[model samples]
Target chain A: MNFNFINLQPYSNPQYFIYLMIALIPIILGLYFGHRFKTYEAIFSIVFLFLIFDGSHWQQGVNLLIWLVYEFILTFAYQYYRHHGKNKTWVFSLAVILAIIPLAAVKYLTAFPDNSIGFVIGFLGISYVTFKTVQVIMEMRDGAIKKVDPVTYARFLLFFPTISSGPIDRYRRFKKDYEKVPTRDAYITDLQYAVRYLFQGFLYKFVIGWFFGTYWLPKITASALVVGNANGGLKLSWWVLAYMYCYSMYLFFDFAGYSLFAVSISYFMGIHTPMNFNKPFISKNIKDFWNRWHMTLSFWFRDYIYMRFSFFAMKKKLFKNRIRLSQVSYFLLFLIQGFWHGLTWYYIVYGIFHASAICINDMWLRFKGKHKKQIPSNKFTEWFAIFLTFNVVCFSFLIFSGFLSQLWFGWK
Target chain B: MDTKQGVLDILNDLTGEDLSDQMDENIFDNGLMDSMASVQMLLSLQEKFDIDVPVSEFKRAEWDTPNKIVAKVESLENE
Candidate 1:
């Protein structure tokens, strides 16, 4: 333990990957030989976690440690409560609310003054880890999670690769992979996918995203600001449009690149954690885009929030019409997701925009279903749908990027 | 010609995707059906069988296939 401690964000740079890939060599070999070296994996998890959570950012690590212990206890307690099979709905609800307190507190702190003490408890990946804990609680309520092995549960939560940003893995899917060693041939296929994803990730995040976010986006934003200044007040122009698209692309490539790395590293460790994006830009509609983009997060929302809420509403007969019920569900889902991003106007608006877009998309789908013959199905129309959806999503991303705040009101 | 076939017939009519051939499929993941379809199908199933399938208690895998759906109905009936 005489090694000099250095901290790095997981998959933040190309050099970090070099170190990680080298470290994973033994684990990979063990997996290839039909065994998962659990002790080594745990040791590395701690070491790598230290690498990320130590140094100047040790606050985050400490906070993460505390939060992990807290959530771990909460899930186990919830599981224990449910063990008697005498679970009340209110108990599960209370557990979920308690589980989310840290994230809610963290998000709320961002609304305070700079020197506010509420900021101290905040940590990187708090939201993601909260999602993981919350899902486990939900699945436990459903009897989907029968057993709670603390060690395996810890592995799922602190899974180093995706502990930061996520292509959120479900407990069942992740546990299945963790519990079994992939056959050599199957692992080779995973390795091939891992390598491909790595190459694609490097190009997307390091190259293209870097080019857009670091190099081009600022230039365009500057140009937009200049145009606004000349126009005698804050007003948008073509340069702002350029910023919109560039920022959108940057968001995609960078985050999707991160997701690819997370999945790639998971594959290297014999877990096929799911993919996050699947050519989202080609989506013909808002719903399709959500299905394809940040898929795990979207699906998480779909299963845990949207569907559950909608069903609850339906049973209560809250909305007379199905469309109204769906619209309200979309609003609640996106609004919560928006607030989750950060406590800001732009983020809130971004969520509302998507919510509204999906409601309209639902209407359009209904209309299209009713008038199948009236609307022509052809290459032109297909491309038009893709083009329209792409622009709409990019515009939403522009708002989500909080650039509009900078444009309309001087960025605080 | 039981509750299973009854569920399948409604699923075949309601789900826009082709579920006739894929009885043992993960109906949701295969992109064959979406949440709306699931909601509609669940409603239909509840009405047809007069069973209480709570959304919270329902796991996707348990009712992912036709056989699983049948098993679920049978379990509920037994209960």
Candidate 2:
């Protein structure tokens, strides 16, 4: 028998879902009957995960396995240490650093030319997996997770639906859902949402996202560059504005669509993986946007990074005032977020831009609180807030897109 | 003062609203608390109770209600 090797990126096309749905039928049936077929589910996950890394991408698959082994050892060792009642701060810090080293290496190495590393060292979803591992390690340090079951940890890491990107499910939350089967009625509700999310994902990704990203984005980029070149000096033009909005819309639809698929599939398997996006464009402020948009990632940053930094700073008396402490935290959070996007000037700028925006937003909120009666709160003001936020976020996205870098320095 | 009253006092200070009667209500969902307020609440809790509350360990769902916060504080005290 001859075997054909194929690499199917998750949610790349409608046909991929057809294949996915067919495979999920058994798992869905088991859940509907109030029995979770754990073994079959594992097999299913392996097959799909294999397909993702098989064929030409096998090197990344190898990388994933190696990375998994490293993380497992680090996680279990840290858990073991914590269980022994020896929670040294330096040990925890070392564990956290060890957890992130591979990802940091991948990010750093991948920054250079393709063959610079000689071979690939990171897999798809490496950043997301790092997020999960770091979360587990941190929680262990906090005594939130006292035990690390190897199988459960493995299952959580390799849960295929959100593996590529994420709706970044926590280990404990995923474990809870994985351990129990939803009731028949609840499973039916899950199916309902699964179907709804699947269709909405199709609409957003295939139709709208395609129209903007595939259809309009190229045209707008071309026109923007042309117009900017003609005008010279930072290439200020209406086309740049068009590119900003179009790129923003495309970015939203594509990622939100992909997130919906991840979430929908997760529901089918009876794991209520969180939703990533929730009408982000309607946000009334930059902080609100972070809450609504890429919610899992933003919340991860908020809980793990921003909140932690604020607590540390406050405890150490790093700042004279709470406001200044928070401001510094915001800068740290967004700057790291920028660097995480890539080692690029524009990404850093985009991070700084958001940090500044959020700081300003905080100041505005304080002023508004002080003079609530003077500044009327009404429908008009609410709409105006949204409109202003939308523009600000779009401009940030423009910086994120690195379009200005290309238009000015002919580099992106 | 008891743990419940101490928690209520802190909640009132942070949210600037009387939360004594709304023991079961989700302060976050009701817009009485947010990310910023939550940080401030944690700081105040640390100062008042001298209990360590790591940011990672604070789940929003587990500590959403005033009663839940009271219980959590008591538990931390016991720990």
Best by DockQ: 2
lDDT string for model 1 (A1-412, tens) is 1335687988887789889999999999999999999999999888888888788778788799889889988998898898988679899999999999989988987777687673366777888889989998987886767888899999999998888888798888888889999999999999999999989998988999899999998889899888976885558788888988999999999989889899888889989988999999999889889989999999899989988888777767888887788888899999999999888998899999999999998888778878979989899998999999999999998888888788788873
RMSD of each: 3.2, 2.2
Error in Å for residue A67 of model 1 = 0.9
For every candidate, what share of the true interface contacts is present?
A: 0.25, 0.67
Off by over 4 Å in 1: A1-4, B12-33, B50-79
lDDT (10s digit) by residue, model 2, range A265-355: 9999999999999999899888889989999999999999998878777777888887888888999999999989988899999999999
Interface RMSD of each: 2.7, 1.4
Docking class of 2: medium
TM-scores of chain A across the candidates, in order, are 0.97, 0.98
Regions of candidate 2 where Cα sits further than 4 Å from its true position: A1-4, B16-26, B29-32, B50-52, B65-68, B74-79
For candidate 2, give the lDDT: 0.91
